[model samples]
Target: MNVEKKRVLKIFYLIATSSEELSSCELAKRIGVTERTIKSDIKQVRDFALDNGAVIKSRRGSGYWIEVFDSDKIQAIVEQLVIHFAYDSSLSDLSSEKRSNDILRKIIAQDGYVKLDDIAYELYLSRSSIKNEIKEARKVLESFNLGFETKPGFGSRIKGSEFDKRLCMLMLFEIYYHKAVLMFNHTQLMNYFECEDDVRNDIRHSFLKVLRESSCHIMDDYTQRIARYLILLRNRYKAKYYISFNPEKKVLLKSFKQYKIACDIIDELKKYGGYDVDENEILALEVFLLIWADIDSTSDLAGDYGEVYFEALTQLEKISERIRQEYSIEFFNCEWDKKIFLTGLIPIILKIKLNCEKNDMKSSVLFNDSVRLSPLSIKLSYSAIELLNEQYNTKNSFASHLIIAYRIYIIISKVKYDYSPIRMIICSMHGIEVARSIKNSIINKYSEKYFAKLDLYELYEMRALKYDDYDAVALNYPYFSYKYDWTFVLIELIPTDNQLQELYNKVILQGYQLKQFLEFFNFNKNFVFRDFNFESMESFINLISFKHGKESKFIHNIEYELNECVIKSIYNKTCILFINHQYVDHNIFEIYQLNEIKNINGEEISHIIVLSVDFNHSIKAFKFIEQLSHQLVIDRETIYLLTESEKLDNIIDIVRKGLNSEMISLV
Candidate 1:
């Protein structure tokens, strides 16, 4: 049945079975379509109902119901519709995407040219609808370098290299039948492939057995993909369609270990199904297995294949570096992560370089909405594409970019939770035992959960220690005379429940505040200047505040604030000048390594670090800058690194580490 007729039948069944009358709006909602579409289908539904011994009754505003006269005839019609068109009711319209896939499949599956009328008749669509869907299908085919040729009487056929055709076919199968195979819905697979249960099971067994003997571990989804490819290959071969590989390229493929594995699989197929596949078919299967299956070792692929692996690794390193430079974040911090990323990336590189078809059809539908929302992921994907295109001279499809973006998002998200511990100091007037007791209680409750480090200290030691060394300071008695720069809270000697809970909340808040503060320190190379020269403080401020085009009034406000604020010199010889200002529209942080030391008010300045925060910035931003300024004054090593470090990444790393150490104080 045509899609419209099926929809019309569905509407009649709904009105016939519904207990209450359904309005056009209500029917549209239930059917997952617009009210106008429901209205359009209503006339056809009325005609269908009348032919099936029922009449659809409609009132002005009351909506639709059904009146059945011939009960037996109406019952039979409803039963047939339920059996065939019931599953389609929940689907919105026969969407253009799906219709295109159907049309593409029909043309590809045919031997020569497929008539438009035959497709329209088979799909129950009009000539016009089929033509529109053909355009969409043509775009997809063109991606694989396949051509859609249509003549007056002969209709249409996809014209491309056999390899490209198979690739397109593999992509289509992945889109349409992968889920069924994944679910082990054998009946659905059998019906779709037009194969018997025995034949399907034998093909799966043959593929798995070959993989097992070769010690190859294919992911379950990929295993299903190969099986589907084999089924399609058998059908295509039966129709006298075959893949032909280049003579030289076929010789190079035979040297790979996968070629042997493919031979074994073809041997099993011939054994079980009594069918012989050509050498080109074996080479094609080899390429499929190499792309989809995971082998135990790359040691077996020693020569040309190893060169491909190394080339992919080189491209990956460049892509990773580009991402790091652009985002100021590492793509993969560990070797294991790099290996995982490289493994996933190699197939994409091969798919592009070898002109292999894309099989991850679901990525577009799965990630289109979510990927656009993540600018970082989108940027990372573009970086990867740019690098890959530079290296291989081929552009990735939109689907490939989505897959890369999805992977990048997963890695970046995992990096977000790498938290630094919050350091806390407990002081008691009584003795060490009392301080220990308070520390133990807090640790037992919140230490592991909140990633806190608690240390016991005597109240007399408070005057001897620096407050900036710890994130929070808890005391048994209120010592008003001694000033504290850190978060301060008082408790009883034993510590009350309320006091401990308050301390826990402070620890959590301090950690969050520190994390927020550290985010501003993540500087890209573009923001870092080396050997910078400025004649005066005014020129320096203007240079730092310089943005492209007309500068906002906010930039002038920032310059005013910086000019009014004191620039403190932390060291004598290699003076690290720190300037922090507020009342800006956005947070700004930059470092300028001076070409020549300048004396300002008899203090020599070698490096200048400028920080500006929004007027309505959080307390965390203020606290972070305050703590960092204090550390630069006290910690000589940090100041030395700030003035002396030549590499931009190292400088940024040291700044982050210095601030983290001030807050965390990890033992």
Candidate 2:
């Protein structure tokens, strides 16, 4: 029993063995507790006696009395309790048989519909116990044509013959699945989820109905569960497939597991299937499998348990690629990941399978009291973000729909109806935009008064990439507004190297490029440079250098007139002059006055340009700046270190405009 139950039972035991008929107050004083606690203990003792076929009688004027007629049953009862707790003993080690019967009982009940957590939880066991139990359960139920199916990370189910042990397994599996799904649907995991519990309830029974209908001997019931476990492992660690859970090894696998969940998927195949699966080459294929399993697990995102969710699209490409090579099949799983957003329940038919017969594109980003939420909603939210990221860059199907849903989750996570706000921020940061967009739509669309409760500014800023701009103040007006300039600018820097939507998103490319971006800019300080921020920082630079032949995407308009009448030579290309913030700020024409204006890239660099602009200068003022013949020399790859100061934007703009002096009077 849990600690609470044990403590309560101890109090009850004291009451049961009391010799005198003491008042609850007196008993409470003796036990150093409140009288109410004594009363509760008496009631509990009576219930326990009744449950155990004993008797505990209570009198209104007197104290409570207990009459024990089944002392022998106590020993047997404890022994029975022992059976439930036996799994805990073998947790660290693998005593396979101890957990077999417990798993077997559940397996017999649910026809291949049990959850692994149920198996683990029912016997007071850990995941390893159930995992070990699978081994023994697999053998004992093998001849009976019975098998166990596990949902690893979720729960376990069973399937087999009705008259057979397998039949019993099927019943047990259903029982576990129904209970778990009920808990999942009823519990408030996601915030502001107002849709009826009935929404999920409506199809739950039907889902079980289908499971019963389709859960035949298509495969060994045990095999199906083991297969699911393998799939779970495969999905969770696609890029990293090895399954060594050593505490030290866990540290090594931490990064690979968190970001590249499918990093070592070949480990499972090598360990279980005994195939020489290549760990690295199989990463993409494993990514596909992870997405596939995620689709099955994240049914609510697509609004259909019967259909696949779009959030699994990134993996679908990997799957498509794998199928082409491994199975010589093309376009096998592409249709499912291509679902458009705002469509009917077709996008998320898996959660409420019954309501989504008709697909509708009229979907809203806001929950708006229409979308119900549960614990699984968090899972769906995560999946939606992954899917949206995949969809955003991958351009697959109606993927943006999932993005909206993901945003809704982001907003809802912050506005917890019952959960703590601290928890909300932690969960919402990863999908900040989703939260911000959802909050805004709710405030405007349905006139939600709860807008004030949300950290609207904080949420929006989280979506922003933090950086320094011209004075580092972002201008958000007309259509919208922003307090910090870099809020939008920082948007370009991709933070934490989130899961890749394609090959380029992988660390080998994306991380490498980002590392280069930081190193080139000498950006050693901490900043959240969103994708837009990285691409937008070139607003001031004049010499736009393109990588792989793309022009430098600049952000600011050139101002001021400093007729540089000079041509400075650089290492590679030809440039009129090299300049800094001071050159532009002072409008100093000394670049031409110097005997030699050496390019910084070249070995000889005698003079430099600087631009200095007042903090309040209008961007439109300095219109007479000298123009360079090669105004397109600044490469997007140029690393510009951002410093936090009042003159940040001015300094950056100086280099940006290629001004020889750092002072400028642009306004």
Candidate 3:
């Protein structure tokens, strides 16, 4: 019931219909197979037709003709085949296995003549599987052949007269050439052929042709369409795949049987769900899916996908009642029209949504799935390829899934095509976070390709770098100032109202002093600073309690180094950054300990007490949390968060709190 296998069989019907009394030679030429193949296929064709009540017979020694038992039988067989194709697709491969066995039996009984590769392919086995079976056929059917026979190279033979032998051999070869033969490799054949439009369109069409072949499930048609659809699907998604069997599942168990269409839209609620994208791009994605679907419509990818396609047609006839009965878009329901296929409307719809506009503004062919990137905005060399990456990596996507991507892009285009300046805000529920990380990785991998822009809002779209909330991007080392501008901004956790105001005041008062220090020492043109929680329980001694000196020595050292730095200003000014690290917490021992300790601004100022001389700052909270070190109340991230902004408000609050009690300045 393998859906793909059934589709391939359908291909045989088309190939078979294209010829007159097609012999093994004719079939091999038309279907691009070999004579050996045709020889084996005839038997399969006979058996399949007979099993379904068709007659494949030879008059004496001329050739073969396939006719159903009668008109009713033919109609019934066609209907049955279609039904089987539509219900469960997993059994088409089994049909080949059965056909192969039937041929093997007939060859042994009538003569050594059977279509082999058909079964081999349909069974998803290798050519060797057929060879091995054929070798054993003579022994298994010896009684039927009366020990009739096969030489090293000669095919199976009946002991009857030469005329009978020729008849059987001819029919056998016919089966091999048409029914059983596996024809052109899809990829290679595509290379040989020139597509009508772009590579993507061509690929879509080739897949459709193969799907049609598979739908018929005729042996010859199957031969003509081998591997084409799989190859194309792989190309579209950039995914590699091959039929695999699970020994545990034993899907091929003769008793196990449920074969239907490859994909049933009704059952696949996800793939075919109604409109999952924005208006601008929905039509485009829809049209694109239709084109893709049409190319491989041999089976039903029509799951959720079919709804999009069906709606596009505006099926005013059948859906007329449904449309009027339900949501009412007007009762102009009909098929999407053959025009889409002829004019490459699907691709047009997609490309147009991507800004590849076409003449028809309202072609229902469009489908906008947010996974697709902006068309109005310039796209990468292979933007579609990036989407394919999602298909391969996560088996899901935004453009193909939720409409968030499209909405984001619309916002971005309004602001500017380049989202480098904007910070992309992501919620846990949104899928952008995943894309954000991946995009950053890609950016780092190809630094030259990007200008090193960090936009949180467009992180997923542009492969931007990641910046944690409130984490300042170090602008230290004035020599490197020219290389970058516009420091990335992240929101800080303003612990409390007191802390927020304290920061504003600290920045305003210490603005010039701090700016001078950075300009002289670290050469940071733009100082990004902030403070987290403010407390009254801490003092300079608290820093000393942090196992050693002030744990926030990192901040102090940065300030101390900046104060000692030489400025390029014409005034030849030297600046000092006095930050008092005392707060409400009474862990004074860990508060004010660093280099060149002394009293400044009425409090002890810590020097290069931190690990880095450039990241020095006052961490009064660090001193407070030091008391709970064993319990590890404050983690590294907390430390980072507390020092998110370079503003001294938190430090000021700490100083004010320390003043309320007994405070000591280490500097």
- The prediction achieving the highest lDDT against the true structure is 1
**Model 1, stretches more than 4 Å misplaced?**
1-9, 12-95, 121-126, 174-192, 212-215, 293-304, 317-341, 357-360, 363-374, 406-421, 425-667
lDDT of 1 by residue, 19-73 (tens): 8999998888876789999998888888888887989999989899999998998
Ranking by TM-score: 1, 2, 3
Error of 3 at 83 (Å): 18
lDDT of 2 at 145: 46
Error of 2 at 520 (Å): 98
For model 3, how does the per-residue alpha-carbon lDDT over 1-667 read when each residue is reduced to its tens digit?
4433443344334233333465556556644567576556666666666666566765543555666566665555554443322212232333333334334434422323334454455444467765755554443333122234456554454454321222232223233222222232222213322223454354444434543544423223322232233222232222221222234322222111111222211122123232132222222222223322333223332332333344323321332333222212231212232222212222222332222121111111222322222221112101222333332332212122112223223323222111122222321113445435533443343232222333333323322543433212211123332232324222132124443233223221221122232222232222322221222213332332342324455445424422322120001011121222221121121111133434433243322112112212222222221111211111223223224553433333333332222212212
How far is 281's C-alpha from truth in model 1 (Å)? Answer: 2.1
After TM-score superposition, what is the CA distance of residue 576 in candidate 2 from its true location, in Å?
A: 99
Candidate 1 residue 493 Cα shift, in angstroms, is: 16
Which candidate leads in TM-score?
Answer: 1
Candidate scoring better on TM-score of 2 and 3: 2
Q: Give the lowest summed-lDDT range of ten residues in model 3.
A: 566-575
TM-score of each: 0.57, 0.18, 0.17
367-425: candidate 2 lDDT, tens digit per residue:
22222222122223333433433443322222223433443333322321111111011
